[model samples]
Target: MTTTPRIAIIGAGPAGLLCARVLQLRGIEVTVYDADTAVDSRDPGGTLDLHADSGQIALEDAGLLAAFSELARPEGQAKSRLDQHGTVLSSFVPEEGDLAAPEIDRGQLRIMLDQHVRPATVRWGHKLLSATSLGGGQHRVEFANGHSATVDLLIGADGAWSRVRPLLSEAVPQYSGVSFLDVRFDEVDRRHPGIAALVGDGHVFANDGDGRAIIAQRNSEGRVRGYLGLRTELDWAASAGVDLADTASVRRYLLAEYAGWAPELLPLITDSDGEYVNRPIHTLPAPLTWRHRPGVTLIGDAAHLMSPFGGFGANLAMLDGAELARAIAEEPSTDAAITRYESVMLPRSGELAVQANQAIARFFAPGQAPAPDHEAEHRRYQEGAAAYRR
Candidate 1:
């Protein structure tokens, strides 16, 4: 008989929650840890697209895919692209009833995953501080909330700045010279019809083709969220004397920079409402790997962080969690299971990281020329699925 290991998952994000759910489904006991004081204590962020093969497969493993369909927005998968002059360059609409990929609010996903797990399985409000190794493939983890636990298997599903990452790898996330200024609009259809029409029902992209772009997407509740992307230094905002909190000042600065763009698209910048956030992209070096270690491993962003340009971060994280749980359930030993999980996880994430690096460079290359297909990742998934069927 295989050993039953004590599993402790740090981070109650989608990855951790899914991992715990799968393990429980397989009759394996697991616990999850998170810092959130309550389930909805914080903003659950915006919408996310879950690819069929990755995110969907993980949900299927956890037996939640059927319910997900009831809440998902398949129509939100459509997307359009525009040039600086706001010309409709290209667009994509998934065929009717295409389950290939669907959009869902991040909050909804969190609640769904959280509800399926065993009640009290996740110890909320326990902020992880550090993890220390105990001999024989065990680790003792300390949390900021005056709590601690020792587990036979420690899984870190925490995001980019993972506290558990240092124990496994020394890599650090580096700035990618790509940044986005948060732009949001509430009641888009009523308060901002022009932006609403441009956004349509899905996502819209407009690039100056010279290292500046505006990407907007329609979310639930008549809200729209987007990013004003620029290939600029991390300090560009401060250097330009732009206080990101001041929307008018940010709009003034962006308007000057995008002088020749279509007048109709200007509102995406000037009319945004809500908090302005300057987010600079960062990534752990690609092909990020570590020496085989027993008792502990990582999944999701903690294991391999890549630029969001590749559109694989969230999907991959969910897949990692599900796959890892299955490996552990099927393998004879904890050490053997961890080895099996990392072998595939490391290579896949590495390949996407490399692609993301290239895509980021190509997307912002200094020219008014057409850029790489924004739908490249989606197309690749379709092609891969087709190839698998043959």
Candidate 2:
């Protein structure tokens, strides 16, 4: 008889939840723990383009592709590059019926994954505080709520600031010298017609001469999300005289910064109505690998945190979850499975981390001549198209 491992997955995000679902389907008993009080306790952030080999494959493995397709915005696969004056520089739209990396709201994706798991399989309020090895192929995990669990396997799907990472590696995420002020505009076409026209169906990228940029995306429900990118010190935001907590103040400050630029681009910041979120990008050094340890492993951002410049964070995380589950299903022992998983995952994630860091540096490179080699990117898009065709 095959032995089923008792696995504990931390974090209820896409990686962790999908890991649990995949393992359970393979006849393994899995439990998921998350810090949130409820599933919808926190906003799930912006939209993501589920990549073909990574995210889409994970969803297919979990048997959630149909539901994901229903929620995915396939028709929204368009991109535009705008100058500071809101002039369209370059624009590209996929042919109708194209399914290459269709975008999906983070909230809807989470809900779809949540519905597939059995009731009570996830303990919502269980925030992991620490983990310790108990020998005999078991580990003890302590939660913030004064609860603990002893399990044969522990998978850390927690994000960049994962509490579970310290057990395996001494590495921590380091600032990438770039910060983003997240902004949102509601009723885009109705309230901000000009901005809507600027951002069209998918995304718009506006660059300024002062090492600042604005990336805006048209999300579902006619809402638009914007990320005001600034290449500044970690504390530069405070010196900019903007109230980080107040949306209006943030909008005003952004408008002032881009005062001389295009008025059309200002609405993305000036007309934003939602709360401003501060995201200080961080990344781990390249070739981030750890020694093989029994009873514990990590996936997603916990394993390889990188800058979002390449837009591979979510896709890589989902791929990690899927690969790890596949390894566990193939091996007879937990130690063997984890070892096999890390063997393949370490090099793969390290390469991606390098690519992500390089992408960030190139984006901020002095003089904005066309971004690096489009060969790899074109290959990715083609693969995505093939997946859709399948």
Q: Which candidate tops lDDT? A: 1
In terms of lDDT, model 1 sits at 0.87
Which 10-residue span in candidate 2 carries the lowest summed lDDT?
369-378
Clash pairs (backbone) in predicted model 1: none
Using all chains and alpha carbons, the TM-scores for the candidates as numbered come to 0.94, 0.94
Residue lDDT tens for model 1, 1-390: 087888999999999999999999999999899989877899776788888768887898899999899889988988888988999988888777776778888888999899999999989999999999988999999999789889999999988899988889999899998998878899999999999999888899888779999999888889999888999998998899998877778888889888899988988888878867888989999989999888889999998888877568888999999999999899999898899999999998899888877777777787654544536656666665565336
Candidate 1's TM-score reads 0.94
> What overall lDDT goes with each candidate model?
0.87, 0.81
The candidate that achieves the highest TM-score relative to the unseen native structure: 1
RMSD of each: 2.0, 2.4
Candidate 1 residue 7 C-alpha distance from true site, Å: 1.2
